[model samples]
Target chain A: MIQISRLPYYGRQMLNWGVTIASVIVCALILPSRLPGMELLGIGPNWLLIWVVAWSVKRSVLQGAIAGLALGLIQDGMTSLHPSHTLSLMCVGILTASLKKQRYVQEDFISVALIVFGMTVVAETVLALQFSLVGDRSLAEIWTDHQQIALSSAILSSLWAPILYYPLNLWWEKMNWIENNA
Target chain B: MDTLRRWWDRNWLQVALIGLVISTAWVARQTQGGSLFEVYQLLTRPFQSNPSKQELLTNAKVVEMEAKLQQVEKENQKLRELLGYVAKNQQQAIAAPIVGRGADHWWQQITLGRGSNDGIKEDFVVTAPGGLVGRVSSVTAHTSRVMLISDPSSRVGVMINRSRFMGVMRGKSGNKAVMQFFERVPDVRRGDVVTTSSASELFPSGLPVGRVESVNLSQSPAPEAVIALSAPTSVLEWVAVYPVEKNTDSETSQANSK
Candidate 1:
């Protein structure tokens, strides 16, 4: 990768950081939109959750947790503060990180999509549990609402996960290669 | 000592990076992600729908009729006031576009294009052309989030416009809501208009909420009425925000007791 080294040192670092942060910004912006074919049953894909899963799949447990926490906070700010989103997202991050894909599953889009699908349900269940404990909503309503949200969100998120995961994984792999060679 | 130093040097950068990420996220949460919303508004500006020709035409007619209605209603109110009527204060309306829906399905909320910058504040009343929509729960500089009346957690004191029977309305997770009346033999029927009562501290009195679609007087604890919201909340495009008047009497009483 002579071309990679030919770039000015600080410029390359800045470019990498810029691209990473830009992707995060793009995901955040898409959070509230309900674009055509992007929605199912009035619910759009959980873009941030998908991003978190994609980011954590190849990273450490702590790295995954950090992404989850940050994204969850951003989501809370976007929506309501009470019944925080941090716990559910953090759980998603931790579970995805610990999936140990290298052992049982291959590094493929299918695996990523499957992981995201399962994580989506887990994340939503955690949120419903919080709502139930907090007593903001009746148990009957929360669980009923949970089934609808969890199914739609999971399906939408899994179908959309590969779109984000493919490119980001490529970039990170290249970065890792460069780091090791350097 | 050499091994320890090597370990420290190897991991310090990673540790610092993770810490920075986590702390920044925590701060963003504390501030409710104002910067994120601002960026979201900027990026989505191109996709936002503009006022159509039909909207302009309809608005012109609505404005004319509203002016006439206001004049007549004002005169009627004056007459009623002279006869000892307790007139409720009128809301100051601000028209705003619905920019986005809830970030997650767990919460029933909508993001409006107008915010604190446009004089919108928490607890301001939000209504559409058909009826009461919801209230402003939080605001950023250029965007505000509304908690719709269909949210399961929201509770509002309401009454039958025709029968004057008191009830409490609760969201049932969709366009419909359930109202539980305090009276066992409440005089409520299908198609009766539901409005917020004077007793509701959260909402102003007499704002149209919805219409009763069905009534069950024999329900266990209390009678219940199912209301079908007149406003098409599922596909709301625009809403009118209104300033809520503070209760001066309550403030005076607190001051006197102090």
Candidate 2:
């Protein structure tokens, strides 16, 4: 463990990726848990969504989409399959990566929080659309339920975005700095 | 040829990584994150309160209620025997602690600490203090996921105990449910007790669900009654899971609790 930092550049890169993977695993495990201060009206922060946003905010469009797809599938594994989370999360990834292209949103915590807020509502809306399209439930019921889900999810996810973003952003920036200097 | 080789050198690793990630995710989605739940169970084991220990900590009032319930259950069993009806299952109730809740707000589910290792299977009914809570949706070796009745997607066949009026009850958010009556006008009162009907294939019949909170007539498709669930849905700490099996014989009762 002491020699880890002195390893070759490739080993360091591998370590960085390993850390990234571990972070995803941590988020997945906590998705089902409603730990204290992490819960709101029986809803916890959308951890996977947070992970996706953090990943996509600085990556390329393709990288963002891939992260979204993978995390969305994992979320589906945690919850129900119908109206799969894939489409919404993939869309979130693409939009977020593109949102960076315009430079309209700054890279501050407040802007990140705002982005998470908008993205969560979009993700939930896509899910509600799929539910309505399935025709198993009534339209009125789906929309009303959508309203509750979107608001709570948006509020909770936005508030918790910084907790995840800070560390991940720090590591990614460090890795970028290393790669650039080397 | 030079350009092609250059492109391959530049992008092969990224493409391979993406392929690997996508396939793993697909598998995870299909398998319902079995390994993740296992890890979660392992991590949460130290934190979860022991069910047996919780039972021992029960107050005098609950012990009294249990005694009363056992007496009524005995009477019901005897009455069914007298009527020449055979019971369906002889499975024991597995006590489980609620370890986690739904991954998101859209799905109303809770993860249980007990699973197949504890004899819990899919479709087993879960109940809390007051009445029916939900059904077991998925299970890993040591953890089971329950799809709650309060989810909008969940539909249960329920009846008014007072008038025997039947209806299909669909879950609304919170502790409320809307029961759509088969009859145009159902004879339901505000305080009428509701129970699972015999027609429901998923759940055992006659299990208590909730009490009628309001009766709504002149609705679009059919008259509906709003029920306030007796079981504590939002704040469930421990729940009892009863194993259910398909009934081959013409047995009326489900739990053959001998």
Which candidate number would show the highest lDDT if scored against the true structure?
2
RMSD of 1: 3.1
Provide DockQ values for all models, in the order shown: 0.74, 0.83
What ranges in model 1 sit over 4 Å off? A1-3, A7-15, B1-4, B52-54, B57-72, B84-91, B246-258
What TM-score does candidate 2 get on C-alpha atoms? 0.93
Q: On residues A63-174, what C-alpha lDDT tens digit does candidate 2 reach at each position?
A: 8888999999999988988879999999999988888733775657988898899999999999989988898878998898888878888999999999999999998988
Clash totals, every prediction:
0, 0
Model 2 regions more than 4 Å off: A1-6, A105-107, B87-89, B245-258
Error of 2 at B111 (Å): 0.8
At residue A25, what lDDT does model 1 achieve? 75
B49 Cα displacement, candidate 2 (Å): 0.9
